[model samples]
Target: MPYPSSDTPAANPSPADSRAARLWEALPGLSYGADYNPEQWPEDIRRQDVELMKEAGVTVLSVGIFSWAWLEPSEGRYDFAWLDGVLDSLADAGIKVALATATAAPPAWLVLKHPEILPVAADGTTLGPGSRRHYSPSSSVYRRYAARMTRALADRYGDHPALALWHVDNELGCHISEYYGPEDAEAFRGWLRRRYGSIEALNDAWGTAFWSQRYGGFAEVQPPAPAPTTLNPTQQLDFQRFSSWALIDFYNMLAAVIHEVTPDVPTTTNLMASSATKSMDYFSWAKDLDVIANDHYLVAADTERHIELAFSADLTRGIADGKPWMLMEHSTSAVNWQPRNLPKLPGEMARNSLAHVARGSDAVMFFQWRQSRQGSEKFHSAMVPHDGTATRVWREVVELGAALKALAQVQGSRVESRTAIIFDYEAWWASELDSHPSQDVKYLTLLRAFHRELFLRGITADLVQPGADLSGYSLILVCTLYTVTDAAAANIAAAAERGATVLVSYFSGIVDQHDAVRLGGYPGAFRELLGINSEEFHPLPQHGTVGLDNGWKGRIWSENVRLAGAEAVVSFTGHPLAGVPALTRRVVGSGAAWYLATFPDDTSLAGLLDSLLAESGVAAPATAPAGVELTRRLGAGGASFLFVINHTGAEADVAASGRELVTGTQFSGVVQPGAVAVIVEDAPGGQPG
Candidate 1:
């Protein structure tokens, strides 16, 4: 469903139709726990896990995620004795269960029987069953067996008291997002026939006239396989869309069975909604889910990874339409995937968990409850490490759980933001295609840079879809939105014309949804709103930088911009486009529009953002020292909660009046180094006084 417009407020959930609300009502406080894998351990260890969960205030556990093989060792055979004991034990311990369908990994027996279910790479190599997620997304045989398994689980456990939610296949499309096998080709053709309705429409949409690539019929089309040279950009883009749709279709298939069996139980799949996981367009999939859940792991190489964490959490909240989401999976410490795999610093785990909660995550969970003794992820951090409960990780986990319980009132609250940044997964797929102005022009890079500036200044911004309601926002930032629909472009322009401060970065509005150029000049769709036109692009060398008249440096990109009605705010100094405007502003009806033609240095971008925020009348919740991250959440009856996270070594003072929930005392507006605080403000309104 399209998001609610400014005039239409999002509907509040009721007991009759909202399984998410039902699940939360069943739980005691804010949900806390991890993915519990009892199949990997013995009965004694499983009993010990129940005790530890109670001690740590764990309200829920995701079980049977990768237990398909254990549940069904052979074809048409079943073994539910062990799972029955596990679920009964969890229920006795008062822990809710997000029971999985256990279809993430097909059993070895099924794969051995049907080798055609395996996924094939673009290079025609078959991915075997040695790893997880090895099945082709479009395989009917795989879907048949998966649906059977889902039905069996739902039939047995649908009415179980411990079942709070139904977890769909684990992290759909985490690996093998695209397949090139015969089955995939057939499915692709069927999807195309349904989408375009005719072969001629497909040819026109893909612009196949170039290079004699026009398709005579849907049967002749295939996945964008490797060729002698670069494949058609539109074909590749369509394949990306098809791949995501295939996974969504698979998920919907299983969700249908669950809904039929248990109409009141919520169903969700963990989505990787971070910068690192970009294959899936989560916004398109959000409406199908009963609750939104996301998995995010920090990049070990980045020094300021916490900012990236905030970005991911905020993006997840945006996908949920400002509703509270679930932190489905995040490592407690170091992860084994990155090259270095450095362990997190002391107190970083608590800070990370609270940051997500501050950004609208109602539940806090980890990838696994106990560290594995042997596996690819054996070295990955978990709640219980190899050294046992005496470790710092365990202590912090218990402490974070108590903190969440104290802040239980924040569960249904919503994060407050008046500024929005347009984010589109299709645009991300198209912007970084084989041919572009610069390879350094990454969609996430520009997004992170802009978001980091706002983070540093203690401002909150929602990462919204291109077609989302823009009238509710005071400021809108469109960064590297290379491909957009004509309706979306008109919506953004209309927002600017109605008193919103709009900023358009370089390379946006250059193409349509079909990957075809908009025609005429650069940024064709936004020319009238921006009041500027660019004739040509001037991407700088890999290491080159150009001087700007504002005493800043521009890197990677510059354009020969011509002013139609906008006033020049900054210009290039000594390049081929010297004296041409690098930044320009124009007054649209009651508002203003700004255009940036090049990438600016951090200082320069920060200054420009400051001016934009001021002009938009958007300000931080409170003035605080550097390294203090502040966020606010609003609840019913004018209740407000302020989250203050101090990442610096020195003490920081934020101007606020409230009762701190963590320490259960009156807040003095002073936070200690490396500490986190959640305060219930005394003020009636959600905003700071």
Candidate 2:
């Protein structure tokens, strides 16, 4: 079949399709609040909770994330004691509900009573009690009870006035483990059967005979584990594929439970941005979801440099296949997990959220509504506080909420993008897991180097997946794609061949989905797509820096790249690898592809990326002087907005092409410390937002 399938667009979905769509229609006037645990609160406090939310303009509340203990008080007995009251109070407060599936954890009583619910890690170690998300996805007992609980919630609250959305199993990878026990092995056999149909076809595709992975029928197959590297790349790739599919199956079963009860309500699970390691194939769950939401967390605060966020949003977008999105979980303030939990100084939260909207976001809610007392996230910041309000974070949240309300019309609008970046977890995993060269060169890092530049320069970048159409985009970057199906590779090549500028990173196109190395040199399979053959590689240590051999040189890790249907635009200097191609560009069809062999500093990367954006006609924030930052988002009804923020401790010069929304002034230069400029326009070059 042709790539991306040119899918038949759905007929206007029925009202019975989901109440979730009703909520989307109501999105502009809505407000998003975070995890509310009325299960742990008293009636009076719960009442106060409603008032507090209303004060902050919170129109929707995600209830029951950790309410399994309250709901399933016993194995077969169910109690709606606290939950019923919570809903009644929410109804009184005029709050809509995105009811959680409440299956993230089974109560301790259930876990001890039924040890079968306990999960085993890939290494055969059993996860114990005391923490949530430790339950096994494939454990039959767990699924049965989880389904029962979902059905109960649906049957009871499906028609509730407060019902708006369905949140399934909060933060799906919080447990940090994947199952590979005998249970997984059993499921893998079944999954393999469905994927390849027959053992002969599977063997033919995997070339199993060479690796002794040959199976007579299906009984011989087992789930992939962290085992002998000597195993054939095909088996290894299959194991990874199996692992990804297993998680999807696990989620599917949970979702089935939700559908069984509340078929009219949309269901979705929140995935994290940095979890390529788990092989969560969200593509498999796209249509199954009412909305694709993700927790945007990164170790570094380089909002522009973190292409992972764009990748997350893009992948999330495609999962729903161009449907609007939700930033279901993100930090409105400093995150405790990073090495430096720097608070989002001033307008950063507003800026980052707008960036999501610029690409395509329906709402920008955070992970936490209130700070925790004690736990792994004890220090995580929240929009509200344990101290009963009056905190900087809470104050900022209030202000940000007001801003969102002001721009309500922009909420569900998607950017009609001309640029895209394909984010493949499979390719990321394959590049990282390879036995060859080096693990230091992370595929994601390579991708971010290009994306960060576009982000800071105020260019909209869409993150997409393999086989997605590139006709809508003028530029597409595919980084470190070590392994992919021929179908996917073909789509990318087709896009580049059709006048889209492509950036092909090192170590890409080296193998297939089965981990089989392509004939010829590196990026062997995509040589034609990229139009190059790497003759030699000049690998460098992390500290070994190089300057471009050109008149301009800077400190960066560089390598020599050979050119074919491309030009040696940049090369390394000062080291033995100096005077060789570090960067090359090739015109494919009517467009082009630029290849980078090794990692480089952000500064150098910015130059290359910015130059590309300029060539593509995407404009940067006009007057964002030093210490002042800018961004823009495409909104509904042909409206767009540019965000100009001051990041300096002192006042700085700001640029603007139109009137600012915050102050309604045509900004030129000189913005005060921590000040902001929100420009609203009509289209690409419309008014200031």
The best candidate by TM-score is 1
**lDDT by residue (tens digit), candidate 2, 123-148:** 77888878888777777877788877
Q: Estimate each model's TM-score.
A: 0.97, 0.88
Off by over 4 Å in 2: 1-20, 204-213, 226-231, 275-278, 298-322, 332-359, 374-378, 535-538, 545-548, 551-567, 570-582, 601-603, 626-629, 650-659, 662-672, 682-689
Residues 314-398, candidate 1: write the lDDT tens digits: 8998899888789989999999989899999999999999999999899999988999999899999999999999999999999
| C-alpha lDDT of all candidate models, in order | 0.90, 0.69
Show model 1 residue runs off by greater than 4 Å.
1-17, 684-689
Worst 10 residues of 1 by lDDT: 1-10
CA RMSD, predictions in order: 2.3, 4.1
